[model samples]
Target: QPTLRKLVGGSSAPQLPDDSVRQLLVEADATNELFKYCEGQGYSLFVAAQPCSYTTQVVAGMIYTVSMSTEPDPGTYYEIKIFKPLPHLEQKARVTEIRMAQR
Candidate 1:
């Protein structure tokens, strides 16, 4: 998956429309807020994935998994994961395909 920074910067990357760019920016802001919240809660943040444009209506943001303790005991380790979807982007699938025939 290409990061938003690379997608918007590289010449070879598909040029996104202005509205899509704006939407991506909004998602980025939301991601930042989530990071701050995790920090305040005393958990170390790890970004599992950077935000990426999934489809015309959707821009998926980072996946975060946070953990606080480093104890070797399994019971002492706990992790909280979070990924917030863009509300406006959530939609029903519009297309379905059967198996493609091989030549």
Candidate 2:
């Protein structure tokens, strides 16, 4: 999987650090912080991303997922696991489910 830094818009692939502080790792940490804040406020966080084929078997299919959660504190990490469907899974089916959930 590409590091979260790249997923969040880093310019280049991650590389070894010159010092103890790994910038890419720090960036990822910041992203998680932001997500936590959004979730805490009851925001519906949506991620519509084109994940690379390295992790996702399908190269072209875009992934969409909604997440919301409560946290214990700054250190506690919670995730909304959007299940990656099989290649045979229909995108329309997922969309329908999401729409129905909102109704």
Best candidate, lDDT-wise?
A: 1
**Model 1 over residues 1-103: C-alpha lDDT tens digits?**
9656534422233232355443443544534544555567675556432332222222363333323233333343333233445467673221111111111
After superposition, the stretches of candidate 2 with alpha carbons farther than 4 Å from their true spots are 1-28, 48-103
Q: lDDT at 30 for candidate 1?
A: 39
The lowest-lDDT stretch of 10 consecutive residues in candidate 2 is 94-103
Least accurate 10 contiguous residues by lDDT in model 1: 94-103
RMSD (CA, angstroms), candidate 1:
15.3
